[model samples]
Target: MRFGHTFGRWVLDSLLPPRCMLCGEMVDEPGRLCAACWQGLDFIAEPLCPCCGTPFAMPVPAGMLCAACLAKPPRYRRARAALVYGRGGRDLVLRFKRADRTDMAAGLAALMRQAAGPLLHEADLILPVPLHPRRLWRRRFNQSALLAQALGRQAAKPVLLDGLERLRPTPSLGGLNRGERRRALAGAIRVAPGRRALLVGRAVLLVDDVFTTGATAHACIRALLGAGAASVDVLTLTRVVRPDIV
Candidate 1:
């Protein structure tokens, strides 16, 4: 069996040449970035804001919160992201989300799992931020759902794909400010009917592809809490980390 597996891998590599996921440069393995691309990514690490997981440039006292979190705490208990959403990271996410690169789900989930740390162990269930039916139809797949499923499998936890539902389709929030974004997403999401039981008194790990201003995550967290979820923690593949905040 081992020999057959090795032979199969050799055959596959010969055919596909193990190109890098980001740059398409030939590499040692599939689902990996070239060294240059890897170095270009800013992986979020320690000395981050305890509340929102924003990376701190300079060392601060442990358990310190960022200015934004101090001003307005997010609805979720905590949040973690694997990468800083910059050039390479943003391109990778956009490719996965818009280019039908569902194959990238596993690799992205692996990064999220690493960033999630204790959240995975503490979570009672995994839930993906839902896409409205209209958007889902247009996108063909909810990228968040795909990531949640992959992460749940990695963590050996049950994924509740329909636990939360987007009740209405909102306009693109790309250029909206924080207040506008919040208002736009208000009452746009809810716990799906008949799925609340799974959430009641349970700790949920809310999964998403990217964390921008977190308006979407906050709305989902509110809905999950209202459905009797004990708490919600967020995990995302990437986040926009601002140096000015620290």
Candidate 2:
């Protein structure tokens, strides 16, 4: 039986060689991504808002904030993304979330490490936005948690998987304006028991796969602050840029 199992594994390996997650060219390792697609990532860098992490062309004349942040500050202290959600980056996120590639989570997490290493070091606890029980049952996995674990592995930080909980199910936020999305997510998150003390006077980094209208991250930030988190930071694989660049 053991010999049969070993032979079966060898056969499976031979039949399906590992491929790059982006272009599907057979790679030396299954989860390995190709150099072209990797380099194709346009990472967000300097001259960013000290609070919201929005990249700006130049530093604000006298302030630490960006124009969008001046108009409306984010709930979290600072947020940074690995890439602007465009063609190739967005395609990878979609594949990871919807197609169950799972492997893509590691790739995204690696990019995030490059984008936000210092932020990870300041964190006392790492929390992934929780999926409501119903969604968890259906999906059988939370993409945020997967990203968090991969990050924890790389950074040697303890990932508090059970520290946050979604209080109830939320309907899909598709087609909703920012305000509508905020209202939908209101009162949706809570800190788990006995874990609240860990956040006191400690910097917390909320992990999520994407940052859209900022509604989801804001909702989680409010809950964490209410639970006594000294401050909150957000890390995401991609940030959605609005169309019609003016």
Question: Which model scores highest in TM-score?
Answer: 1
Whole-model Cα lDDT of every candidate shown, in order:
0.89, 0.82
TM-score for candidate 1: 0.91
The reply for model 1, stretches above 4 Å from the true place, is 1-15, 244-246
Error of 2 at 226 (Å): 0.6
Q: Residue by residue across 1-246, what tens digits does model 1's lDDT show? A: 646865776687668877777878988866678899889888999988888998888898988899888998888899999998988889889999998766678878988888998889999999999999999999888999999999988889999999899889999999999899999999999999999888899999999989999999989999999999999999999998778466
**What's the TM-score of each model vs. the native?**
0.91, 0.86
Clashing pairs in 2: none
Q: Which ranges of candidate 2 are over 4 A from the true structure?
A: 1-17, 28-30, 58-63, 243-246
RMSD of each: 4.9, 4.1
What lDDT does model 1 reach?
0.89
